[model samples]
Target: MTRGHFDDGALLAARLLLAGLFLGGAVQKAVDPAPAMALLAMRGMPEFLVWPALAFNALAGTALVLGVWTRPVALALAGYAAFTSIFHFQPADPWQMTIFVKNWAIAGGLLALAVAGAGRLAWRGGR
Candidate 1:
């Protein structure tokens, strides 16, 4: 229709895509939390926190997909991304920068969505 409508549509599409990506990962973790936990443990996070982390990811992913508590959910996702990036750091393979970069990129996108409020076409925000 108009420019604003197109912009909102694009924003909503972006948000939904990101949310789907996050939710897919959460579902994978839920289906087999042991491997996710083992990965986290290998990254040096405490064993006790694994379950909580799983729950957080699942809940936050749902929130994002549903456009419920969008800002807070995005912020939480951003925090998770930052934590994961820090946990996955490898000093020897400087060429393997994609791991950290991807996390940071996702974090930035989540943060942007947090600030942008999911736009008007989102499930919760649509006009």
Candidate 2:
């Protein structure tokens, strides 16, 4: 395969991996929202926010997987990752700290995606 082909494949893989994470989170929240709601409440955020969060996860994740409106969607998800990382910032808790760092890493990948566009393997939905 040519360089473009390899690039496209790599981009597609990244998109799939990132999108799958959100999709999985959406499904988990959908299946049992109690945990998420409780987390929100503990953080002093409105429990209702979980609904919109889940919706955004599902919709934006689908958009990410499809490579549609990629730049904006990736940017939004990147912001989402960084913002959500705030919730995981518990220095005394190793698990939370790891997640907080992981969230930043995800955000970094998403920032790259925002700049890279969807590449040739994408649908190219009119742009």
Candidate 3:
């Protein structure tokens, strides 16, 4: 659709799905921080960085879900997804392939949100 004719309902649906997915992942990490930390450690990230990463994931996901500061959150999540793709998914194992595709797809959607704003169907602002 043209920018002016963008479907707000579709955008809202996409945003909600993305936001829920992000929030769920963040909650999973928060609920089991040790495993998340272990995964990060296995990826060679510093141990001290795990908590902050977890917090960012949670906060950014929440913001996206709530349609609060949507552009910034989408941009942050797009960066996070890019990092995940480059760092966590480069090995190209079967399992990693799925994650790589998923991350990139999410990144694409987030980038769209960043460009399009949250749309009129969002809970705040534009609506």
Say which candidate scores most in TM-score: 2
On lDDT, the leading prediction is 2
For 19-117, candidate 3 gives per-residue lDDT tens digits of 787777778777776866766788878777767876787788777666788888899899888887754565648777788888988899999999888
Root-mean-square deviation of every model: 3.1, 2.2, 2.9
Candidate lDDT values, in order: 0.75, 0.92, 0.78
Pitting candidate 1 against candidate 3, the one with the higher lDDT is 3
lDDT of 2 at 86: 83
- lDDT of each residue in 36-88, candidate 1, tens digit only: 77767887776657668767777777777667788888888898898788755
lDDT for each residue of candidate 2 in 5-74, tens digit (9 for 90 to 100):
7898999999999999999999999999998888788799999998899999999999889999999999
Q: What is the lDDT of residue 6 in candidate 3?
A: 51
Kindly give the stretch of ten consecutive residues in candidate 1 with the minimal lDDT sum: 118-127
